[model samples]
Target: MAGSQGPLVLGPMLRYIGETDATVWVETAEPGVVTVKADGREWRAPTFSVMGHHYALVVVDGLAPGDELPYAVRFGDVVVWPLADSRFPPPRIRTIDRSRPTRLLFGSCRTSVPHDREGNSSNGVDALRALALALADGEEAWPDVVAFLGDQVYADATSEAMRDFIAERRDITQPPGEEIKDYEEYAHLYGLAWSDEAIRWLLSTLPSCMIFDDHDIRDDWNTSWTWQEEINQTSWWHERLMGGLSAYWVYQHLGNLPPAELARDEVYAQVLAAGSGDGAEGSGIDLTEPVFDLSRRVDRHPEVYRWSYRRELGDCRLVVVDSRAARVLDPDRRSMLDPDEMAWLDEQLTGDVEHLFIGTSLPFLLPPGLHDFEAIDEVLAQGAHGRLVAAAAERARQTIDLEHWAAFNEGFAEVFDMVIDVARGNRGRAPSTVLFLSGDVHNSYVAEVTDAAARHGAQSRIVQAVCSPIRNPMPRVVRVLMSAFARSLVRPMHFIAARSRRVPDPAFPWLVTDGPWFDNCLAEATIQGPDVAIVWRGGEVRDGDDLHPVLTTVGAVRIPGGLDDGARAGESAADGRPTVAR
Candidate 1:
């Protein structure tokens, strides 16, 4: 058994790549020492057990900056990765280069389904797959890192494959039937989501970071106090919450940390100390109790664990905030972030960097009309109208997903103030751009804060860049409704919002300058010195090939640095649509 190399169950994913070190995460079929050999150097880490799943994060250090080298994964004496029949080239790890500008690929809300004609027709092409194929074929420039904003897997809205797995395990008619109920189910769900060969290879080569959104736990996960009360009543909510968080720790959150921070993590330390013994069955440590206990503590008191992290790439700072679990749900003091998380975010929003990227799963700036509508819903739900109206408002809020930053008025205002201050050089030397990178509305757009408002004609360019649905496409009717809200209804909504005594005037007015494009797409943001350029791309099938789709540019825009009002807000076009400011 010790000599036998077990099949890799999930990953050989490259995560947390830094200037001179990188970590590789993997899941093995059995408890074993995972080895990574790159550039004539080898590093090994023993697998730790999470429930019955065996995994390891091998930290490779002492490499020089800008070193790009092919790597291989090994279990015992046998090679388990870069499979003999694989079509892609050997996966390589590229260390950070301080001189080069930062290029980041980002998007959210992907559903795992067949990549055939039927799935493509229903969900549009898989933009991520297209990116991977392009990179594998040496057709596009490689991003330094990829940030998946949210919904890496939909625990609430299961696909047919997930539902079938659920049916196999439990009664389909029962409560939480199709929804994932425990760690095992979540593990299976992740397997389905990441097992695609092309994507697997992409993950193996590309450094990636992720944060969870509503669907990772459930839809409208912590939308309000009422939402919590309702969900807490369900028989399976405890197990589901515990399971979801534990799995998130094992799968997504673990990779977000660099070696130093990861070493300081209490849960990781405990797991490492506990140790999974050998590749033999029944020899591994069972982490269910400790892991679930940690999850329960987190769910009960979100302040106990923070999911947010900040990374400095060259002169750019990328702060990925956990807008979900760390929420303050008291209706009287509703906030997207709790006090501690907000304070942490405050520290991260400084302007010393040339570009500051604030990544939240939910968009910080919504379309103007939708922002007003959501704000109105929040106010009404808090009894701005009356008790009867408030009750109805709460129901409507959950039903239609009016739970973005706008719904948490206080938090939204505070963060907006922070951005304004940073843009105005109050925090540090004002960065050239203070940008919010987000997803989760099933559409994509670029919104710039109106210069005449609270922008105060600041030196920095403040913009919201949104991309969503790396695969899942919104229905046509919903697309039409979104377009109308994004463009046509802005004036009316603003007028209505101005009349609401309970809703304070927005810190600034903004407009969607580029898109409300409802494509299954991804967005790439490149920061060169002080200037920032954004491009959205989607996959398009050619020659009746369902699996091999080519990436087509959907939109492109640039935010000029050291802005003068007359300085051109750059423009670009794709699919015969204007995608930037005039």
Candidate 2:
């Protein structure tokens, strides 16, 4: 068995499993009897794989509601602890608070460069790392949970460490060498990606939930069916997907769901109900086997299984949409979520909670200019822009390089309807805030949603808060152009599209009333009391031993409960929206 080396990485962490007893899972480097001790009880999940990515799920049941308890894990004779750089103070515990409204820290598009401590010139601090540091330093209070929106790892955008690891494991001179192309390589990539100190500690200490974006597989994946077809024809496409999806299952997906849910899952049930918990003759399960067989079937027929995950925290319910794999690729009927998945999303959006947080890797609402550009290009895809422009647009789509909800109108409409219905109180009490947290565009901003109050009058309510690139920053030129384009052109196009399509566009011609810029940043929102406030803070940039994780205020927007009524009556308060000073 391989001995543990480096810092014990305890993350993609999660906190506050809500009123229900929590179930924890981890993949160990060496399997020597792993046990999770919490709530004064210990549960053991025997090791099943020799590769050291041991999957163990411990169910911490029968706990009192709204109680915070410290917990720890043990591996054989050695005690496996959360990293020293943990964000929240170390006793590695869970707080089960139901009365306090949940505070969720969410953002995505983070890259894992070597931490500065290793003498490796790194990209600034990880946004999650900064948040962790803040929590540890008491600069910021701990959130009830952290939801990692997407792109946790870029299989296509591999790092030096990832490339080197792949080189040692397999002969790269072979057809798909030097980069990850299959299940075996993907498994190795995950191991390299998560082996970090700050992140490990963060994951171990916080209860994090995650979903996948394009980079999680490849950039701009599933923009259209044409893109899917083009990628499928590539020499290394099959292996790449197999590795990507398989690793996702082991590293991310399994941990997001409750043990009971997993047990009920057909695939996981086979693994659990297996007699010896090993790949025995009559055991009926083997997790180490290539996930290609399973992933391929799902890709071919997305309706067969759904990878989306959901959880309820007190009065708030979070629905994480699986935008990539579950897409409907048919030419005539294209959408982000297929019918079944959409129905599942609709069901989850019903009136059981005070707030609904929909986590999609791509923002449902993008900069208006970008949205229009995509809409125009999509029209070109259908042969509207003569031949040359149409061909060029189609090429871009085939290469997987488009963004915006219009690319998948079917799915966009479904989500839009969900938002509208929820806002209109069709789904229980309209959440105090129907907030969307997203990351793919690489720049972060927040926008509020408004509907025509009097059969065509602008009345706003829905809000979108975006945080991106926990490390990766966009090029200066691209950023300038995007900012200008969004400010000038995009806003008008949204209104035009709404009118031309005869769809009820609830969006107002909004500006970046907050920010259109920021370096790698993490976003946090608190739903405590009757008020909701969302804030974004940039990450720290270090030079030598001088760590500068400055918390620059990007923008803070507050949604007051009575403001909607005031706005409707034309009784405008400060800044026109009913917001109290933060």
Candidate 3:
């Protein structure tokens, strides 16, 4: 590797990886020639500027599948990797081998704080940092890929350090000053989130993907048409929405695309056309105006833009949905996914695989009791009773996030039927395990759904595995409130709520078999030939020179296939066994 590159401002983060192609993203103090060298090949790309921020994505191609390669990042004559790499067995990444089963690591809601005494005491421990420490200590096995479910950063909940930076630059006395105001602020937020030594190394060597939740933009963003109407009236919301979505594109979403898809990106092509003369110092046609407009257009008309994507891993298919931006918030016809988005999801739901993983930031299947409560709230909020009742319900709904899948009954039914068809082998050959990997609601738990309909040969085990609050826990009061709410949904209340819609019973009934663990945690999903097992683990800081994060198992469950249509859930252990559905 060359000499130390002028201190990397952000990442050597490994992004998308195909059988023969890979993408690496980075940010530096000032833009310069960025290069990646590995497997006896070299790839060079120049950084582009957006509102004075410099970024580069170097795509390496022509690599064989399962190729084990040591890669280095160089900015001009400075080596930005190798020395900064992790001191573990597999320091470099090995490309994906399509023949192997998919092992995915996932979680959400992480706060970026220092890994020292003061930081830990203030914000608790960051599970992401903990995972990084586990990797540093050789205490965890590397997975094939990582998925950040959502809320990767909280624009509404700024830390003291973030506030301090905001105060230093602009007037803290002004409106919308405490929270993030624009793309520049978002860049700083991402820098704080990704700059830690251990996590940086882990990200540099792992293939990763991400989606944004409410907090990533602002609390209760796009929750309802009413909420949208209110927010749009605010003076600062327009700029804030543009900033949040645009920053997401540049930071998280852009890297998720493969080489062909990235080339097809209209904005990327536009930027390239305007940036032909730039020599990595960001001396080209400015991109601020066009990029910002593009972002705004995406929010204004999400149907014109496509943010959802699907990828096939070995015999398993991974579908990551954009549950936020692509929403239809009509009061009479609210849906988490618009019709176009639903069509896209319908196309992706077909199965001829052993395992199918659906990644949504919000859990599709919450506890049956909790799901009933949200559905009831939505009905009341939609004027099922009266205007006054509707008004009160709306307040409660927004206050407590009664805007998940169950709240959007139409959308929920669509999703349920899609999964049911795939499970029943209506699309293609039925998959063995239909797993929904999600993280939201600030706790970890898993539930399993048993289809009541007749099965086609092999019945799929539908399950929802939730891991949340990688660093952010619900405040004690909120936790108590949620618990009380979950417990108070007795049989009579839930029955009344479910009957209010006069709809037929669900295709499957599910149960929470594992936990609602409220600790900073990460989760792993292991898929065998026809079985899928998931485990949630919390992070405990161990005493040492470095704040070492020790992983502790919170809960684990295995959902197996090969069950007959008449088969029932088996009595088994909480770790990796089947449990009866509610």
The candidate scoring highest on TM-score is: 1
Clashes of 1: 0
Clashes of each: 0, 22, 2
What is the C-alpha lDDT profile of model 1 across 337-435, one tens digit per residue? Answer: 999999999999998889989999999989888999999999999998899999999999999999999999899999998898888888989888888
Per-model TM-score on C-alpha atoms? 0.94, 0.87, 0.93
**lDDT value, candidate 1, whole model:** 0.85
| Every candidate's lDDT | 0.85, 0.65, 0.78
Candidate 3: stretches off by over 4 Å? 1-7, 84-91, 271-285, 451-458, 480-490, 502-507, 544-546, 569-582
| Candidate that scores best on lDDT | 1
Q: Estimate, for each residue in 48-69, the C-alpha lDDT of model 2 and write its tens digit.
A: 4422355555555667667677
Superposed by TM-score, candidate 3 places the C-alpha of residue 152 at a distance from the truth, in angstroms, of 0.8
Worst 10 residues of 1 by lDDT: 573-582
